[model samples]
Target: MVNEAQEYLADPVLGERVAAELRALLRDPNRLPVLVLATLWPVHWQRLTARRDPDAHAQARALLEEGTRIRVPDSFTAADAHVLAAEGSDPRLRRARECAVNGEITQYLAGVPVLLQRYEDATADARALLDAAIDARRLGWGVDLPTEFLADAASGYLTRAEWDEYGEQWPAPALADTDEHRGGFPGPLTRVRPRRRLRQTAPVDRPACRLADAVEQHGRRSRADTFPAETFWTASLAHADAPTLITLAESARIRGLYRTQMQLLATGALSNADAAAELVNPLTIPALGALGEVSRWAASIVPLTDPGPLARFLRTLHSANQKEAIEVVLARGPGRRAELSNRFGVADLVRRLYDWNHYGRFPESVRSAASAELAALLTRHPDGPTDTGDPKSLARFVNMLEAPAAACATATALRPRSQPDPDPSDAEADEAPETAMVLASRLKRLAEAGNDRALIDLLAEKPARRVAVSDPSGVAHLLRELTRIADTYDVDEVRQLSKRESVTLIADRRPLERVDLTDPTGVALLLGWLNRYHGHWTSWPDRFLHRLEHRRDPLYLSLRDQPYRNAEHLVWQWERAMLGRFATRAAEVALTDARGVADLLNTLSPRTFNYCPQPVAQAALARLLERNPAHHVPLVGASIDGSAAEVLIRALRDAGDPEAASHLQQRAFAAGAYPYLRRSEYRDYGLLPDGTWSPVWTWADMVPSY
Candidate 1:
């Protein structure tokens, strides 16, 4: 009953009311500061002004003054008369007076009430999300939170690896009940946080010294005066899983607990070995000053002595951990020159540095050293660029664009192949593969500065299309000023510099502005850019429509040979719109291509068959009927079991149009006028006028490879 009453009194709002009543007694000059302190939290009194407060020493002395050092209660029970005198028989009556006195000046009224109680009231999922957001903000991890936080809150739970990796939402699965929906209990291997491990309550302020301790502990009005997070991190580290330890290291990084983070970094047994990399992001992780002596040697900075405790600590690590630990040393330019080579081959270390380029947290000197070594490796001609990675990695070497023209060319040459968090408490790890974020930022910055030369300079640097798509948040800001961004380069320059990825991104995903298309350059660029995927005949149509749908001009109709034939997959309903537009094109122009003929067959108004006004479709079907199976590829994008032209031919023949049939037979043996659906070298051949054999191709075979 007493515990329940104490919890009720702990209510922050009620605590404020009780504080006012205790402070009101201070107006009686007879009251000793010591007695007054016993009845109220020192926080309220510290903020209060006494008459002698103007002088610094006087203020300090007055704040801690005692009346002749009289003995005070070892602990003040609220039942004591000193407190009960100010307390009221009715809680409501006391609240009404305190509320009337404080009025607008109260802390509760200063801002939206964000009491910790509200955080507790949130659902597990919501609380996790809130905690993750708060953790990310405090840790300085970028806003792009991990996927765990993004999953359906009701179903997914953050894993130890994920939590340690990204610091998503907390509850750590082990801490929460086994929801039937989320499988059985997490099991014995799961490390559950102790319920009361991190926080300790001060024994409810007892003697005069206890109140003084509260004042000392509370420090200034600012929360920064307390190193409470230190305790939070320390408790977390003692019990955290390998993944969670990384998060603790990150917290230590935030708290300037460099020594603590360094100790953690020396441990290689972490569930995720990458924790060491995260701990010392060069600038954030300064050179471990004076635990050991560091001196400069050429471009290499070396520790003259061992890195103090870290040297002994390295012996305890696994090989991988030892490698990472030494790399951290080498990266900080502290260890011997060949240390990286000894631990990881020189070539391998270069690749690790390349990976770190994506991190963007490495010190400039470290990054420069890595880049120089990589360049030197390339210069030696011992191994080709392909020795490191594929063209895709080369393409997306986040800093590849930041590289000078020569270095970017090297990365471009190497491009082709592209390439788990354990901490639940850490909730959010750094943004995974922030390459998009990094590239987008560069584009945004370059675009803002109107550096057309630099923007165009990126024409040489390329990544895969999906990889090149900028982050939505970054792109949103980019698009808001796209017109200005577009103006940075000439319209012709855009076409000249545009990669297949960029053309598709603007044409489909982030639509180009009307002004960009006014010259018809961007439209043509979109069309040409689409030529890269002709190999996937089934998908090419979808790609074309997807990429061209945003084009203001209906130039698709004007093209003599449209590559895409599938309409069922029309994402933007462009098939219907394009068919409607096709009604206006000349019959000869529309009939030659299989897509044109197939469009006509499916789009015919079901209500009427006689004198169908789709003459282009009608003529095209007649022409196709003339050709035998040998004359066309067996199947095109629009073709059913029979070829597109063959299917249409049957429909026309069934319609019993003699004029069309006569026209079909008259030219039946003649060479096909349109592209074949399924042409092959074996059947798709013709006799030359000179009587020698030559390959014959439908019009599609003739469209130049862009």
Candidate 2:
């Protein structure tokens, strides 16, 4: 089709017709030549332009020359030359000529009339584009123009009414309710409001009087009605409520009004009935079944008054109950009849008893009641040598001795005398070992029962002294038994004793040489002790070094079996200590042994080496150089040698006739070697036989041996 067009254009008649058609289309203000040709022949615009006849080009040039003759603004029409710049059948050339000579030139020749006409045309075009955009937006088809085009067009054509209508019609989901149609309601419409459905009535009946009044009347008279008292008390205890009940209880207790105080105690409306009970219960005769409750009640009350009496009372009750309970078990005598005894002997019961007696005062009823029972037992048993002559019993007797009043008040009592020094000579005069053993056993039971003082007293006895000192297993067993005692219980003395014994045992037992070096726990304990006492003694270094060197064989064996294990850890510790004590020696060791050097170097982190001591740094560097000679020249050239090189120099000098020192110094001064170092200084400080500095041969004077 393109070839047919070209052939036709070559003929005069056909070419003339085609040229006339192109001219007609180009001259029309609304018709474009490219669009006209495209409609007639659906070929590429470039191909269509290339098919333009020679006659068409001549006609276009004539039209442009004619259009230019009409005077026009330079801005209104494209220059005449721009139309004919491209040759051949180019569509751009035709379009350019048409735009210049036709629409633009005609508008420019018409002057201000043309300007107003162009403005009106532009405004009409803008409005049409806006309407098209809005239609697309309404259909949910996105706008196609760039942001600038849309913004410019919208600015020129959008009106206030149009904007309002657009917003109302296209309200976002969140603002849909505020749209014009929704806002046209007669009254305000809230999306959320209280429900209007039938409300369910609560089933609970309302009281006749206010809760406070009802609580006050019914809460005070009966103990069983504690519910109302508890509820009312909680409500009344609020910071905003009146303190009538609290003030009444305080006033009643102060005036010695026992019945009034008891009434307040029964009321339970007060926040502190427990406090009131503690004060009042001791003065009342306790009911049989209520002894335990009454004693606890007294203890709770004691802190509110002089704690002395309450403390004494609580201790008395503890001693009495303990004795009665023990007696009850002993009377049953190691049989099924004593089954109830096991339940009462639990550690929890012992803790409770300890808290009650050791923490607070003795209850008067328990003290008074136990006094008679204790007196009867003492009268039957007496203070003479015990039947078993057991040491455990002697230890118990010693604990009993500390609280003389509790024991002396009994029917059997030790004779009182002037203070006398404890007789060491008369071992026989001391409590018999059998009795002491029995007492120690009982005291241990009491300690297990959480009675720290009883345990201490048992430990102080002659028989217990042997067990405590000579028996490591026995002491460990005892510590395990009392392990629950808090650190605050003055157990530091025992801990110190255990530490001393542990050290002795550790030192006496040789470390297992063939065992795992990965398990440094045994060695770690000794090292930890050394760290703990780092500054206490001067001899510790020798002792530590001796232990480390002696244990080296075992450590080595362990490391051999498990190279990837904590083998590095032990070597690190050894290196740290060596560096601390004999840094030079450590360096020598590292230089001699590759594995030891590697382990030591691994311990030295980059951060530590950043500010390491000059000698230490030099030692490390020398060792590294010896192990890896290739790294030596680059390391020196990098200027990281710093003080380490000087340290290495000094060390080599100290050793007579050092070859390594001479070799390094010679290399440093050689041509093209270590350019980073100062050559003049290197020559000035020459190597000596003793590796010391002596004014020696300069770099210029040295012969090239390499």
Candidate 3:
């Protein structure tokens, strides 16, 4: 049909007549199967419509409208491009496929080269408009540019002479060109419709556009060229939200545009504290190889504004081990180091620099300078290192400095010259392993230096003496020193001095009163030590058991959570210590109170009962039953189960409780022994396949009937 109507399509009147018949055929269901397709240029379509006749216009609209309009996409997707490339045997398809990039023809991929070509050839006004659009996109804010903003930005991009030539009528065409509608897709700039749904703050639909993603990528890739000097971006983006500024700031930093990055970050910092803190971002610091312009820009913002941002920025540089950057920044404000130290603290300053220097990053000169600075800081303090509240850290800082005067001053302040010599017999002092380690180290240094007074002062502290007990190496050193003193001095005078140093008394209390059960120190010295190191000190168990029986110590009842194993071990040790003496401390303590009986019985293992003397075992069992008669059956059953039935029966008989013993035996025999005798420990007592008691364990027959 297109072959027949070829000549008529060229003629306006004939084309209209032929288009009318095709439009009717399109509506007909029977003929619709016969597909009809056509293409027309925008210019050709415009020429075919009549300008003067209403009827001609109506006929023209009908012919085109009733036809199915199949529009060709302006660009090919990745898949379409690949298919085109694979089938590039056709020259036209091959030429079109050349335009594809990254397997697809993106708006930017197609448009940027054309825009660049246009930019090179275009007159001043067009270039101005394009420049404004590029800068806005390069700002790295989100890609939503209002047409009005583009116009304003473009006006700002124009010079005085250019603006004079085209003031209100800046003769640049609309950003979305009409040629785009005709399938000539020029890019790096494209138009978009406004999104105006509910909760959408986007403005009314008009000419809204954005630079293609390629534009920003291009800007970042090409950093050698000069960025625009116009302040229009600042004024236009002044009210931009924090997130947008942060994004732009990050982009600026990546592109080595430090001034731009700081400007964006500074603006964002006004409303966001985190953004304020972010001014310390390592990339944003001018001292770390940023351009001179950036250095100047930073100087303008920091030290001149709030010192908090500058201090944080300095700390970050120091933390990253960037020594040169710290020096450069500190050099900016001569008093910056001292000012920051005063504001935060010398302790914090020492802590920050200590971690860096501890790893040995700085040179000797740099370390010496840091030390001197710290020493000077110490001098300014009225009380030296003591004022810092962390003498160990301050002392360590000065020691690392290796400055003799500063180290001495810190030591002197730590231990005053006028400090009263501590009471040599004070045993009530608490012990801390950490503090002891530090003091012990200091004492060794002082003793090596032959600073007798300083060493004495250090030893006077209670924690200092703890080193003698807790650390073997420390006690060895103390013993050697004492041996040297004993050999060098008169023996009697040395003995008197040693007697004064001995911690035999507590305050004014004598040695006997010191370990009294009611005294907290004495209680801890016995029980706490026994719990942790029970077997190491055998004497304390006997002393502790003696106190348990004789002493009126109410605090013993509060001893909860003490390790039962430790109690068992303590009981065993107590028995060993008591064998030489006349009294059975365990039995005596069990007879004291109901709790004491339970405590004593609970700690009495079968091993202890088997090994313990008969009188002691009888005393414990009788006391347990005397306190609570109901304990008799379980006690007898426990003895049988533990394979110590002989011990329980003998103890019962010897304790003058034969009737109680006989009743217990009858209960065990009535129960038939199988249940209680199943324990593996009872295998040695006696065994039979029928689970009956052996003769050795069948004490019911041996029990003399009362």
Candidate 4:
């Protein structure tokens, strides 16, 4: 029996092997009458069958189609619920019956939430092992985890405390025992086939076991479960063998973990053929640093029609002053361009080379080479149609390159055929726009009636095609109603109205001009909505920043009083704008006012800084340490609250001031405070200022030691 057949088939090597094994079984005349049952998620099955490489998976795809396929109902029937009700004597069964609306009972029947909670209670190393396995499987590394790989990777998950508890027999018996007896009860690991071997693996031999598919499925649905992002995981990956490292690198690339993938490829396990394959894969867009490294591995690989990575690699070389090397690469004859001659691929190569030719970051010599190369490439592949969405942008970029006439003609050919206008009836139905006044009026009436149910229903509906009302009065009225409702209600459903399109229309109208600058609450609400909708912390719209800077009084007021969500959201956005617009304001705020210091320190809190970049906070520290070590350092230290104290302690320890680091360590020991790498970090022993370590804070630390 094969469970999660789709998962097994995702691995290229494993899929071919499965195909071969099945063919052997079919041909055996002496084979016993047998049935093979396999389960597949429709989504994964669709993905596998739709793969572009038909020749590579021809046998596997054919075998899958030849079988008598059966799809189990994803949702439950009424009879199923009645059966659940009959078993209602079991509380879990009763709950499942109650919650099985629209046939989403699979979640309840499988007990996804309960399983996740139980998994959360497991030992850190156990959870780490399970997470790694799930990620590997999800990335097509195969469901059957090798025993040696798990054992080798387990040490990366251990903390200082777990290391001390388990000592040198670190991952062996500890891993097997933890998996078998989590919470002192029999766990999933105890149920693997040949359970006796699980208990009998000696201290010296490699441990062997596989997790149940049910547990892995539960882990997949969990929002919190992920492989450790710490450097330790990368260090562990470096130990992987050539085949494993190559598969793992491919997985990392698909997941957009480019840095991790780069580190994996740098292990020298990737052969020239594998490196060439990686470069040719459209999905494998290497980072600039990775492009340079991968270029070395791909030195002998044939150049294709696509020059994106190669062009980027050449730019890196040029930046590093490798002028002669750039010339050598540019002079290489294009080989095997036939396979990469697709219209989209050639167009992309043209665009990339064109970008390099016009970009100011490249040296003039390199830009000229890029332009010349692009002119030659276009001349060779001038027949394909180019369909650029933005003709003007394409024309501008092409016009700047060396071969303006040929480049412009290529871009013009790429322009898509003009689309016919939509049917009037369908167009009206699809894009029925509503005025902002009407949306705001409807929202205000819903709130005033205090019908939270109706309000939630309205917000849950698909938002209108557009908000016709962009006037300042209409936008303000809409925001005022949203803020008032938000202040009154504490539920998530009501707050979700903030995400709807009508709210976005207000920002589109530029309502900042008319908002009352005196009301900090209104300004805070406006800023929060704008920042949330803007999507990223680093990129605040210039207009939004200008408005805040124009009304500096309110910005300063919000900073002084800690206006919103314990200053978590509003103040965080305010500080981001401050950093963006006025570069030195962070240090000025930290050095001067006590309240500003608290706000600045608050930004360093783990919760806040998780979304925020490190340099923004580090800028303040760098300035504080440089200008006035004695006067301002004490003020900044005095303002450290418990919430933000962890970040400050870590900052001081890493701040390169021996005296400050020593003094901070002593104080942390006295206060039972320790700086950890992550918020989830806990260690038994913390290093001290005097080149020694002591036990970490715990219940035992509260009582006298024996």
Clash count list over all predictions: 27, 36, 1, 5
Candidates in descending lDDT order: 4, 3, 1, 2
What tens-digit string does per-residue lDDT give for candidate 1 at 170-221?
A: 4344223211112222211112232333546633221110111222122222
| lDDT for each residue of candidate 2 in 1-706, tens digit (9 for 90 to 100) | 2232433332223353464454454455564323322112211112224332112234223222222122234343334445444443666445544554443543323332322332234333333233322321221121122222232333323455655555343312211221112222211111222334464763422111111111111221221101111212222222211123333333233222223333334333223323333323432322123444434433333221222222233334445453332222223221211112122112122223234323434455433433333233323334412532343653454344334322222322122223454442233423423332233345345545666555444444423332322222232333233332312235655433333322222222322111122322222222223323333212233443344456554443453454433434444444333333322333333132222333333333233333334466556546544554222322221122323333343334343225755554443322112222333452233223222344533222321220
User: What ranges in model 3 sit over 4 Å off?
Assistant: 1-92, 97-116, 170-183, 186-188, 200-208, 213-224, 250-261, 280-706
lDDT of 1 at 691: 20
Worst 10 residues of 4 by lDDT: 634-643
- Stretches off by above 4 angstroms in model 1 are 1-225, 229-231, 238-256, 267-706
Error of 4 at 284 (Å): 3.7
* Cα distance off (Å), candidate 3, residue 472: 69
Quote the RMSD, in angstroms, for model 3: 43.0
Stretches of candidate 2 exceeding 4 Å from the true structure: 1-410, 413-530, 535-547, 551-706
lDDT-best of 1 and 3: 3
Task: Please list the residue runs of candidate 4 whose C-alpha ends up more than 4 Å from where it truly belongs after superposition.
Answer: 17-37, 50-77, 83-117, 166-169, 181-186, 190-206, 223-227, 231-244, 266-272, 279-706
Candidate 1 vs 2: which has more TM-score = 1
User: Which residue window of length 10 is worst by lDDT in model 1?
Assistant: 206-215
- Which candidate has the top score in TM-score? 4
Give the RMSD in angstroms, all C-alphas superposed, for model 1.
35.6
